[model samples]
Target: MIYDFILVGHGLAGGILARTLSEQGYKLAVFDTFKANSASRVAAGLINPLAGKRFAKSWLAEKLVPFAIAFYQQIEKEFNVKIWQPLPIFKFFSSVEEQNTWMGKSSNPAIQEFIKQVHLRLPFSESINQDFGAIEIAQSGYVDVNKFLDCLLVALAQSHLLIQEFFEFSRLNLNADFITYKQDNNTITARKIVFCEGFQAINNPYFSWLPFSLNKGEVLDIKVDNLPAECIYNKAVYVLPFGTDGFKVGATYNWREINEQPSAEALTELTERAGQILKKRFVVTKQAAGIRPAVKDRRPLMGWHPVHHQIGIFNGMGSKGVMMAPYLAHNFVANLQGAKLEPEADISRFLKYFTGI
Candidate 1:
């Protein structure tokens, strides 16, 4: 039987895309080995609209945030599993200048949509150090990425839609209308193959030409006392509230050493930064590292292979996969059905690099 789509890599992107296509009445098979230290497994699952030191709104945040929230909530209702948790982000102001800048930008209608409140005097002064005060960002939260992926994989496995193995490029045979691959004693066929292999895409012969700027990031989970559990606290480093008395601190970016091993330098950096923010005693509980599948221009990669029309990619989500995957997955499916992809994300932008074209 020829499946409508065969997805490679069941990480965040592939999982969401598989669900999107399946709900649209497409038969699909997912290929994955569930590798450890994958970006999806190590992601903090933040959904912040405002990003960077300047606090500019994320690309397409107005549309992506609402759509993502609805999509995750719908999945929860259908599966009866808890994954999406909405929480506010308290962005601490580093200096009076930063506070003034925010004060000025808060009046804009676009920025106002995400601003819950702006404080001149530090809020939660007893526990946090925000001398210049902070701004509470609305419509912010995190997804329990591990739980979501695990639940989805289980359902897929039960339905015989998941193939727990790596996809070997040499075994794939592409025809004019469909593609076939040899797996053990069986031959699996699919009309189209979409690769969502994350940073590992760099090794894929077809899609490797796409400019990938991968980065390794490390996050630490800690148990702390007296820090507020109501919201995520952020300054230089983010202290995300987890279970009772626990917080996930992290994310040191290291582009030089792009591997999945946690480093002592990153651990020290995270703990020290977290210490400056949370004045209470804390104990490190866990440390994780993963490589983000970032692009040079910092946008998702989507679209068909320039020469191989049957091949496609839906990857390079970087740190925003939790928020971007759902909406982007829907959009990608729409593109497959004759709609246009968002130009910035379309791999067509790099068509010149594809020698096959």
Candidate 2:
């Protein structure tokens, strides 16, 4: 079989990239291993407007948020699915100095537009220590990535473009012109191969040299009687309402040990941290862990392979895949369609590894 492009992995990067390329009228095929541990399935898909304890604006929030908002809305209408939700993160404040620092930064015209002047009074039915008010960060939300993947795979399958088997790395044949993979009696070929392997890319032969400071994130699923059903509550960890009687609370970002298994230590940490935040006691419903494809530089990595131009990558989204994928994917598809590349995400800047820059 032949296609204009073949995408490996069906997680956020692969799914969104495929959609963008398809929208631009590109003929593509997608191969997915459907690994249960892929970060997309385990993610809570929170899109935060601010980052760190001082409540600084996330990178490119002014531009990325608007694009993501419109993009998800269009997808919902086109596919008739509830993929995005507007959920405010009540960014927890720990110290008066920290609060004052943030308050000062919020006044900066550069960031003030994203941050609002408030007395720090926000409603929380549960009890959380708030000497100063929490910042009600707006234009922040989540995507039901799992649901989006399911619907997108089905949609692509209907078009005869999705294959469910795991992509075997040993069988991959990469050259300057094409990439091919074979399993059982079938073989697939395409002019270009892009690996959106998420954290698994830590093992990709081409991108291993990139500084991927991987971290393990663990989250909890719990059912409560009547918690804040609309807001994402935060103290040390975030309590995200998942509809019905349950909420998804997480996450512990640990760099010391990176593996795809939920640990009891994480469960205790999250539950205890959450217990201190919530006024009522909640039951732990589920626990899962996945490694984030985080980079030390903390940016999405997009570019053709250093040697093999026919190969490419769209990983290193870290925890912001929901927020970053649409914006970057659009650019990625555009570059493939004869558009110039964005400087920050362009991976060729690592010319030290290239034989020729």
Candidate 3:
């Protein structure tokens, strides 16, 4: 049978894209091995509109946030599962000057949309230390990534649309009108194939030249007493409320050592940073690490190969996959249907890398 599309890697990008395309009435199949320590599984799935110390609005936050929320809600209704958790982000200020900086930006109309409230004094002084006050950000929350992906894979499996195995590049055969791959005793043919293999794309001979800047990030799950579970707390590091007394804290970035192995140094760093805001003692429950598929230019990578138009890529979402994938998937599907790809995200920007093409 000829499929409309074959997606490689069932991580966040591939999963969302496959679901998006399938809903649009496209015949498709997904190839993946459900590898452990993948970014999609390890990610906290944060959706924050304001980024950085200055609290500047994220690129295209106005559009991406609303679209993502609605998309996830639709997915929840379709799957009858709970994944999208809408919670506010309590961004604590470390200094008076930092608070002043936010006060200056809060008046801007664009920034005001994401700001819930500005607390001049410590809001939760008992469990938290807020000497310089904090800002409550609206339109922020987290997706239950593990639950979402697991549910997606199950739905795909039930429909016989998922091939649970490692994709072999050597077995792939691409043609002008279609592509074929040998799996076991049978061959699968599809009109187009998209590689969504996260950081592992660096090893892919076809799209490896796309300037991937991969980084390793580690996160920890801990049980803290008396910490507010009503919202996510952020200071040096973010302390995300989990179950009753549990909070997911993390994320230390390391570009030098890009592997999935959890290190002691990262554990210390995370605990110490989380300690700054979480004054209460906590017990470490779990630690995990994964590599982010980031790009040098800090934008998603999408578009067909310069020469092999039958081959395409939709990756490099970095840490913002939860907030960006659904909307990007919609746009990518639109591009496949004849619309122009978003210029910044279009791989055409790096056409120079495809030297011999």
Give the whole-model CA lDDT for all candidates, comma-separated.
0.90, 0.80, 0.89
Model 1 lDDT per residue over 77-105, tens place: 98898888899998988889988988999
lDDT of 3 at 122: 71
User: Looking at candidate 2, what is the lDDT of residue 121?
Assistant: 56
User: What does candidate 2's lDDT look like per residue over 62-140, in tens digits?
Assistant: 8788898898888899889898888877766666776776677677776666554444554544545555567667787
**TM-score, candidate number 1:** 0.97
Question: What TM-score should be assigned to candidate 2?
Answer: 0.92
| CA displacement after TM-score superposition, residue 101 of candidate 2 (Å) | 2.6
Question: Candidate 2: minimum summed lDDT over ten consecutive residues — where?
Answer: 116-125
Q: What value does the lDDT take at residue 228 in candidate 1? A: 75
Off by over 4 Å in 1: none
Candidate 3 wrong stretches, greater than 4 Å: none
Work out the TM-score per prediction. 0.97, 0.92, 0.97
RMSD value for candidate 2: 2.3
Please give the lDDT score for candidate 2.
0.80
Tens-digit lDDT track of model 3 for 1-357: 999999999999999998898888888889999776999999999999997656689878998899999998988999999899899998998788877888887899988999999877774477887878889999999999999999888888876478888889999998879999997899999999999999999998889889999999999999987777888899868899875568899788899999899999999999999889877889999999999999999899999888898999999999889888888899999997799888889999998888754
* Backbone clash count, each prediction separately: 0, 1, 0
